[model samples]
Target: MTEILEPENCFCQLASGSKGNALYVKGGETAVLFDCGLSGRELERRMAERDLDPTTLSAVVVSHEHTDHVGGAGVICRRFGIPLYITEATRTGSTKKLGKTKAMDIQAMECGKRFSVGSLEIHPFSISHDAADTSGFRVTASSGAVLGIATDLGIAGHLVKEHLSGCHALVLESNHDPELLYANPNYPWPLKQRVRSRVGHLSNEEAATLLDAIDRSRLSHLVLAHLSEENNTPDLALAAAYGVLNGSNTSITVAKQNLPTPVLSF
Candidate 1:
C-alpha cells in the first residue's frame, strides 16, 4: 500500500431543484461555489449549516444563465470578494439575474476550456439545456481526484459520458418519473411536453440509462439531483439508479431541493 498526501476532493449540494441550485466543491486549499441559485443570505446560511466558510471561497462559477443557477452569483462573489467565472454568452444572458457586478471581478470561461482555481482544475463541457451555454463541470484535485457535476441537463449523450467518465464522485440529475409527470393534473399538456423535451430535463429512467453508459468502476459517491417535488419521489429516483447499479459498492444519495446534502469526499 502507498501513502497519499494531497487532500481528497469534496463537494455538497447546498440546494438543487427547479426553484434554486447551488453547490460547493473543495480540493485541498481551493474552494469554489459551483452555483448560487439561492439568495446570498440563503446560500451563506446553507454553508453555515454545513460548517463551510464562505469567506474562503476562491470563485463563484456559474453553469448557465438560468435563474435557478445564476440568481445569486453576483451577490455571493461581491460579498466574498471572489471572482465570478461565466461564459460570455451566459454573462450576457444573466445580465438581469446577476444584477450589478464589478467588471474586473468577472472572468470569462468558454465551454470545453480548462481553468484553474487554486489547487483545483476545472474543465467545463457543453450540455443539452434550454439555457444559454449550459455546462457540466469536471473538477480535478491536485491529487487526481475527480468530481463530476451534470445536473439540469436534458440529454446525456456521448459527450456527457466522455466528460463524466472516471469520476470519483458524481452529481447527476434524476428530475422526474414519466408516469407521475404525465399524470399530474396541475401541469398543462404543454408543460408536460416541455418537461420531457430534448432540452428540458432527465427522467428517472433516462438518468439510469445514462448512468449505465458512464464509467463507474471507480465511482464511490453518486448523488441524484434536481428531482421534481411534484413529479418525482426520492424512492423512485433511488430505485431507478439501484437497478442500474445493482449490488455495486457505491454510496448513493438523493439530493433534496431545500436542504444540503452531507459533504461527500472522493
Candidate 2:
C-alpha cells in the first residue's frame, strides 16, 4: 500500500516587508492575490516559480493605498485582465502613486461587506492605519477553510480580533521590536514616535498580544509578516510568536522581504 496526499488549499507569501508585499491564495477554482506590492514582472516571476498561473487569477485585492501595498496593482491587473478590488478612496488616493496605466476593471469594495471572486468569499473589515480606507480581510475558501490577513495595521482591536478568530491560518504583521526600534540611533524621535503610535506599525509585543487574544484551536499555520528590515530580524520575530504559540500543533514561519515563502497547503 502507498500513502496518498490530498490537494488542499494553497497560500503563498510572494513578498513581505516595508519595501513590498504580495500574497497568493487559491481555493477550489479561484485564485486571488491579496496585494501586489512587488513589480508586475516580479510578481509574475514569483508566481511562475511557485507553479501558479497568472491567467487563472480571479482578482487582485488591495488592502490600502500605501505604495508597499499597492505598488504593482495597476500593472498586474492590466496585464492579467483581472479586476482590481479596492475601496473608492484607495483608488482615488492612489491614482498618482500607482502611476498612469491603461484602464482596468475596478470593483468597489466597502468595509464590512462580503464579496465573491471565483471560489473564495472575502469579507473586508476596516483597520486602523494611515491610509484612505485601510482594510483587513477574512477570506473563506469553498472548502470552509478560513484565512485571516491583517498587516500594516497599527493595532489589532476588537474588530480585528473578531474577524481573525477561528481562522485556519493567519498572516499577521509583527513589524518591529519595541526595544530595538527605540534604541536605534538612525531613526529620529518623531519618526520613532509615529512607528509606535496608534496609527503606526505593530510591535512584536503587540503582535504577540493580539495572538494571545485570538482563538488558536483551529489554527494550523501562523505567518509573521511585514517585519521591519532595520528594526527587526527573523529570529526575533519568530521568538516573539513562538512565545505565544509554543507547544502547539500550529507551524510558524516568517515572511521575508526579498523572496516568496514556500507554499502552505491546508
Instruction: Give the alpha-carbon lDDT of every model.
Output: 0.91, 0.90
Q: Which stretches of candidate 1 lie over 4 Å from their true place?
A: 1-7
The local distance difference test score of model 1 is: 0.91
Candidate 1 steric clashes: 0
- The estimated TM-scores of all candidates read 0.96, 0.95
* lDDT leader: 1
Model 1: per-residue lDDT, tens digit, 91-194?
Answer: 99999888776543999999998999999999999999888899999999999999999997888989999999889999999999999999999999999998
Q: Taking the tens digit of each residue's C-alpha lDDT, what string does model 2 give over 66-185?
A: 999999998888887889999999989889766654478889999999999988999999999888899999999999999999988888889999999999999999999988899999
Q: What is the lDDT of residue 173 in candidate 2?
A: 95
Clashing pairs in 1: none
Candidate 2 structure lDDT: 0.90
Per-candidate clashes, comma-separated: 0, 0
